[model samples]
Target: MKTIGLFAVIMSAAMTVQAKQVAPTSSKISPATIDQAIRLAEATSKEGVTKKITIVTTDNGKSTDVSPRYTVYLGYNSMAEMGNISAAYLIAEDAYSNVTAKRLAPGIYQVQYKAYRDEAGMVNVTKVIDANEAFINDNEIRKACADDFCDGTIKAAVDVQESTTSAN
Candidate 1:
C-alpha cells in the first residue's frame, strides 16, 4: 500500500509538471503582424517611393552581396505643422547613395538610413548609415521604440494577446 501511494503521488506530480511545461504562461506576438507593421511603416516613408538600395554581408573575412529585399521609410518633423512628416523610398543593394553599411554578422545585416524632407516636400535620401542583423528583426524594432515613434498602444495590444492566451 505504501509503495502504491508513493507511485500515485509521483505520477500526479509528474503530470502537473508536464502540464505547466506544455502550456507556457507567456506568449509571443505573431511574426506576420510584426512584419506587416514594419512593411507599412516603410511604405509610408520616402524610401518606398524610390525603392532602391542594397544589402551586403560578410562571412569569415569574406564579403557577400545580398539584394535589398526590404524597404525603409523615414519620419521627420514637418515644417508647416507641429506634427511630423514621413516619406517612403526604396533602394537596391549596391546602389551608390548616402546609405552606409554596417556589419551585423558574417552574412547578416541591418541597414539604417536618414531621410530628409524639404519645405516644399521634396524628399532627399541617404543610404545605409548603420547596419546590424539584430535590428533587422521585427521584435528588435518593437523593443527599440522608447519614444513617440513606437507608442504604448502597440505594446498594449501584444500584452492583451498574451493574457488572453494564458487565460485559456
Candidate 2:
C-alpha cells in the first residue's frame, strides 16, 4: 500500500509538470489600440454614423510577434468619411499598436467593439464580445448589429448541415 501511494503521487506530479510545460499564454489587444478604436467610434457616432472595430488575432497564443497586424472597417455612408477613418486608424496604428502577452489559456478570439459619445462628449464602449473563428466577411456576423450599435452577443459564423453541405 505504501509503494502504491508513492507511485500515484509520482505520477500526479509528473502529469502536473507536463501540463504546465504545454500551457498557453494570454495575449490581449493593447490598451492604446483599444483607446484608439473607442475614440474613433465616439467621433463617428457623434456625427450620426456607426462603426465597428473587428480585431482578428494572428495566433491562438503561440505567436512571438509583438506587433500584431490589424484591419479596420468603417460603416461609412459617403466618400468624405472614408479619408477621416483611414487617417485616424493610420495615426493610431503608427503610434500605438501591439499586444501584451501573459500566461493564460489558448484561444483564437475575434473581438468586436462598438463605442458611443455621451452628452458630455465622453467616449463610452457600448458593446464588446468575443467570437471564436468568426467569419467577419459573412453578412450575418458583419451586420449582426444595427447601424447604431451591437447587442453584445457572440454568434457562430457557420451552421452545421450534416446532410447537404459539402465537406470541402
Candidate 3:
C-alpha cells in the first residue's frame, strides 16, 4: 500500500480540466496524462488505506453566526474518484443557498457559506449536519438549521460528478 499526495494532484488537474471543451484544450496535461490519472486507482491496492477528515466549528451551539474552519487532511482509500473533486465546490443545498468549502489539511478546512434566510421560516441558518464517510458514500451531504433542541430544517446535497485525467 503506497500513499500519494492526491490532494496536490487533484488541485493541479483541476486547473488543467477547466480549459477543456470536451475537446482537448491547450494545456500542458496531455491526453495520456489524463488517462493515467483515471487509471491510478486501478493500480493501487486499498488494503492499508485510511481517511481522516474532520470538520471543526465555532459558534455552532447558538443559532447565531456559524463559521467553521479546518486545516483538512484527507487520505482517500483510492484515487478512483479523484476526478470528481473539481465539482465538489458546486455542491449546494438549493438553487439559492450553498456552501463554499476548501480543504487545507486533515482536520483543517475552511467553509464559508450562504443559506437562504428569506426562504420562508428558514431563520435558523447556523445549523449544519455532521458529515462522515457514510454520507459521502451515499453521495449526499445533509444540513440542518438547528441541533438537539428544535434542530432546524433538513437539507441535503450531492456533488456533481465529472472526470479529468492526469498523473504525477
Candidate 4:
C-alpha cells in the first residue's frame, strides 16, 4: 500500500511538470489574411461600407486627414543609439505619405482612421494616420506593444473620438 501511494504521488508530480512544460500553440493570422478578411467583411456588410475610421497619434497631438490613402505595411524602428527593435504594422493613408521613421524613440503612438462605404456595400475608402514610438520600453518590442503600450492611451483616444463624432 505504501509503495502504491508513493507511485501515485510520483506520477501526479510528473504529470504536473509535463503540463507546465507544454508549449502554447500559435493562433497568429497573417497580415494578408487579415487584410483580405477585412475587405471581404466590408464588402458583405452595408453598415461596414460607410464606417469611418480615424487614427490619431498621442505623441504629437496633431491629427491629419487620412481618408484617401488606406494602406497597411510592415514597419521597423531603427535608432542610432538603441538599434533596430522589431517589426510592426504600418498603416498609411497614402502610398507616398512620409512616416517620420527615424525620430521615433521608445514611446506611445496612435493611428486613427475612417472608412466610407461605396454603392457596392464595400469599404472603398479609408482614412489612416500613424505615429511612431509614442511609447516604448526596453523589453521585447512586439510583446511590449501587445501588453502595455498598444492599449491604454491609443485605445482611449480612439474611443473618445469615435464616441464624440458618432454623437455629433
Candidate 5:
C-alpha cells in the first residue's frame, strides 16, 4: 500500500511538471464591425442629451443647485486615487445616465471608454463636471471597512460628501 501511494505521488508531480500553458486568443477587428459600432454610437447619441447639470444640494436647511462647471481634479488628492467603482449621473428626477468614473475614485476604471452617450434616453458623461467623493467612496468601499479607505483623506472626503448629499 505505501509503495503504491509513493508511486502515485511521483506520477502526479511528473504530470504537473509536464503541463503546458496556453495563450489567450486574440481576434482581428474587421472594418464591417468597426462601421457598425460607429453607426450604433451615433444613433445612441441622438437619443437623450444633457443640456446642463443642476445638482441638488442642501445648504443651511435649504435646497439649492450647486451645478457650477466642476473641475476634474487630478493628482494624488484627485478622484484617480480611489479604488474600483461605478456611477450613474442623475440627469433629472427619477432619471440616471450611465457614467464611467475615471481615476482611483472607487468604482469602475476603464481607459478608452464611451466618453458621451448620444442624446437618446439619457445624458452621458462627456466631461465630469465634478465628482462627489461621498458617492465614489460609498459605492467603492465595503460598508464594514468604510472607515479604512486606502488613503486617509479619500475616505474622509467621501464620508463628508455622502453625509451632505444625503442630508438634502
Candidate 6:
C-alpha cells in the first residue's frame, strides 16, 4: 500500500509539471472578428462606408480607437520577443485594418500586421467593430512568458548588448 501511494504521488507531480508546460491559451480574437478582418483584407475599395466599429473587450470594457494605420508590417520583432507566434499572428491579422488600439493607459501596442489599404478596409472594420476587438493588451513580460518558455526577453537583451559591443 505504501509503495502504491508513493507511485501515485510521483505520477501526479509529473502530470502537474507537464500540464503547466503545455497549458493552452484561447485565441484573443473571436471567430466573428476573424471573419471581419479577413473580409477587410479582401475588400478592394472603401466607397461610402460610414460606420464606426467598436470592439468589445474580454473584460466587458470598450476598446478606444487610437490612430488607424493604412500601412502595417508583420510584427516580427514582437513575435520574436514574445515567442508566441499564434497570438502574434492574431493581433497582426486584426491590425490589417484597424491598426493599433489603446487598452491600458501608457501602453501603445505597435505590433504591425500585413499591409492593407486603409480605404478598402474601413467598411469591414466597421462591421467588426460592433463586435469584439482584438488587441495586444499583454505587457512585455507577459508576452515573453506566454508559453512558460520565458527566455525570449533575456535573449533579446543579450543580442542587443552584443550588437552594441560589436559596434563600439
- For all candidates in order, the CA lDDT equals 0.25, 0.25, 0.25, 0.27, 0.25, 0.26
Q: With candidate 2 superimposed using the best TM-score fit, by how many Å does residue 32's alpha carbon deviate from the native?
A: 22
- Expressed as tens digits, the lDDT of each residue in 1-168 for candidate 1 is 999999986565331111101111122333342221221111123322211223322111213543332333211111111122222122222221233443343222234332222222222232222212212322343346423353211111100000000110
Candidate 5 residue-wise lDDT, 120-157, digit = tens: 22222222223344344433443444545433223322
Task: Write one digit per residue (lDDT tens) for candidate 2, span 1-168.
Answer: 999999986565331111101111123345454322221221234444343333222322323543324323211111112221210111112111232212122222122322121322212111112211232322343354335332332232321111111111
TM-score of predicted structure 1: 0.16
Question: How do all models score by TM-score?
Answer: 0.16, 0.17, 0.20, 0.23, 0.15, 0.17
Candidate 6's TM-score: 0.17
Compared with the true structure, model 5 gives a TM-score of 0.15
Those runs of model 3 whose alpha carbons end farther than 4 Å from true positions after fitting are: 1-47, 50-91, 95-112, 119-124, 133-168
Using lDDT as the measure, the top candidate is 4
Q: Give the TM-score of candidate 2.
A: 0.17
Error of 1 at 74 (Å): 3.4
Best by TM-score: 4
lDDT of 6 by residue, 1-168 (tens): 999999986565331111101111233444333322211211111322121212222212234553333322112122333232222222222333334332222112222222323433322221111011112322344454655743322111100000000100
Residues 140-166 of candidate 3 have per-residue lDDT tens digits of: 211221112221111223222222232
Report the error of model 1 at residue 69, Å: 4.2
Could you tell me which residue pairs clash in candidate 2? none
Q: Candidate 3: what lDDT? A: 0.25
lDDT of 6 at 100: 36
Instruction: Give the residue spans of candidate 1 off by over 4 A.
Output: 1-69, 77-83, 93-168
Backbone clashes in model 2? 0
Alpha-carbon error at 57 in model 6, in Å?
21
